[model samples]
Target: MHYDVFNGDADGIIALLQLRLAEPKSAQLVTGVKRDIQLLDSLNLNSQDSLTVLDISMSSNQQGLANALQAGADVFYVDHHKAGDIPSHANLNAHIDLDAETCTALIVDALLQRRFHLWAITAAYGDNLLSKADTLALQAGLSQQQAAQLQELGTLINYNGYGEDVEDLHFHPAELFQKLLAYDDPFAVIADKHSPYYILKEAYAVDMTLAQSLVASYQDSQLSVFILPDTSSSRRVSGVYGNWLANQAPNHAHLVLTLNSQQDYTVSLRAPLTNKQGAGELCSQFASGGGREAAGGINHLPKASLELLIQSVSDYYQVTASST
Candidate 1:
């Protein structure tokens, strides 16, 4: 059996979508909420099996990847994250770019020679690489209106991927991916009234409204932190809302923490847009935390550690900001 394992977010979904569209494959789908990265461990592999992994960190799945290789499963992995050390194996094919400006979908787009350029642009938008996406859209000769449409579509698709679990999402990642498979162009999805775009758009508006009403729990010169209640809306909106905050204050780092069922915080950290570095490293300092340089997350942050997190983030960014 073959499995297509990916992150449930826009970057992951669009990366796989481009690949499957370029070369249609009938493979078992494996994915989960945006924060659910350790997906490889769940599958038991064998010599006859093959896997395609996208948009997930190699460091977090090192053991599962080693097991897959030992089990003789052919693997193709692509990502843009903090990859500690890549394993050298005959059956493993890895394409990793730690560049903050790039994402898995863009990498896939390059590999596919931009056969699905618009989709990649949308993924970039969804991943909150607004400037990069805008540049790409302009380079592709897209009109202002056309680019805006893709950005909105990407945002909505990305918004659906957040949540504590599948239950909190508007559509399960797999189901959303399947629904999206019907359209080669993202514009088609936006144009189709019955498409997931409409549902996600409406849901996104509601969530964003609630998130916007929240004031910063902690705010300083270099950093701002918002603490959200333990609601499905908070879980579903935290990441994107963090992105929104970062965009609003491009010079200040932002942290959005949502109270989870475990009574701990699910943390989303975004490095200042001007200094897109160190978020992953900062989050990695705590347990259940890791991510890319520009954006990172901690699945569980204890209440006692909250002050420490705020301090660490503020100090790190303060130094970085001063140096620059």
Candidate 2:
């Protein structure tokens, strides 16, 4: 069997979408909510199987990846996250770039020679590479209005991926991917009012409004923290809302913590856009946390550790700002 395993966020979905659109493939789709990155653990592979993995941290799934490679599966992996000591096996073909300004979709765009350039630009926007996406959009000859449309579509798609579970999401990631595959160009989705773009846009507005109303639980010069109540809306908007806060104050690191059923928090951390350097490292200090340089998350963080997390983020960014 051929399995197409990917992260459920916009970057992962769009990266895979571009490849499948260019080279039609029949494969089993494997994905989960944005935080569910250890997707490889669920699969039982064999010599006859082939896997395509995208936009997930390889170090988190290292054991599973090693098992797959040992089983003789031909694996194609692409990502823009922490990849610790990649394996040296012929069956593994890995493309990893940890650049703060680039994402997986852009890497795939280069590979495909911009066959689906517009979609790649949308993914960059969705992934919060704002300036990068804006430059690329300009280079592609897109009007400001057209770029805004793509940016909104990308942000809405990203918002839809933030839910804690598929049930909380407006549409499951796999379902969203299939629906979007019908359009070769992203503009087609925006133009078609009856598409997921419309549904997600409406839902995003509701969730974002709720998020914006809540005052920061803690705020200072170097960092600001917002703790969201335990609700589906909170789950759906946590990550995107964090991004919104980061964009609003590009120099202040923002943290969005959503209360989970276990009385713990699901943490979303965004480094200051001006200093997108230490988020992943700071988050990695927690047991259930890991991500890219600009953004990181902790699946479950104890309430007692909240202050520590905040202090760590503050000190890191403050020191970084001074040194720079």
Candidate 3:
């Protein structure tokens, strides 16, 4: 038996698509929303079975993966996440890269060459490598309009993965994959006048509208914070809100904090476009979160420590602004 495990978002789906197009294998797909990492543990892989994992964090499934490898399962793991102490095993083939600018789709595209390269570009755009995706699109002979439409599709799909649960999402990531797989090329799918693209566009518009209206903005000299409502809608749209806040107040670094179901907060930090780095490290100092220098997030922050966390973030912003 062979299993294909991936993140359910555009990057993961597109990465697996490229692999399938190149290798042409029959494998079961295991995936969830953007936050659902370490999906390999749920599967039952035998000693002779092969597992292909893509766009998921190795650290989250380290122990289960080690056990799988020890059981003689052949594992080909490809991801771009913070990996800690990868195990060495003859059955394990790991391709883990933690470059902030690179995503799994781009990595697979590089490994597989131009085969399904347009899908790779869409995944890259979904992952927010807009400039890189545009450049690659040109190289792949995509007209400017075509590239932009693909970019929008990627962004929309990525946006669909943001909600607190499947209910909050535009469509389940797996269902989105089913729709995507129906078309050979995403460009063709998006260009069709009566395609799923129109459905996704309407959903995006509704979500963006709710996101824009829910922001509670506060500013002090150099620091700004947007306290979002504690709702599924807010959780689903936090990242987009953060980006909008950052752009609107280009002079101030923005913090977006929303309450989750557990009464804890999920926080996303973005440095000013001017200083586009170090928010990850700052968040990691006081909570469980880490990402590239430009952007990062904390999964669950206790409500008791919310004030302290905000103070620390504000202090860091002031200190950094002062030093610069």
Off by over 4 Å in 2: none
Candidates ranked, most accurate by lDDT first:
1, 2, 3
| Cα lDDT tens digits for candidate 1, 1-324 | 999999999999999999998989999999999999999999999999999999999999999999999999999999998888999999999999999999999999999999999999999999999999999999999999999999998888888889998999999999999999999999999889999999988888999999999888889999999999999999898888999999999999999999999998999999999999999999999999999999999999999999999999999999988999
Q: For each candidate, how many residue pairs have backbone atoms clashing (under 3 Å)? A: 0, 0, 1
> Highest lDDT: which candidate?
1
Residue-level lDDT of model 3, residues 8-60, one tens digit each, is: 77788888878876777877768876767758778766798889988877877
lDDT of 2 by residue, 26-120 (tens): 99999989999999999999999999999999999999999999999999999999999899999999999999999999999999999999999
Q: Candidate 2: worst 10 consecutive residues by lDDT?
A: 156-165
Model 3 spans with C-alpha error above 4 angstroms: 214-216, 220-223, 243-253, 271-276, 279-288, 312-324
Assess each prediction's global lDDT (C-alpha) against the native.
0.95, 0.94, 0.76
Model 1: which residue pairs collide?
none
Instruction: Give the lDDT of residue 3 in candidate 2.
Output: 95
Error of 3 at 190 (Å): 0.5
Of the two candidates 2 and 3, the one with more favorable lDDT, higher being better, is 2
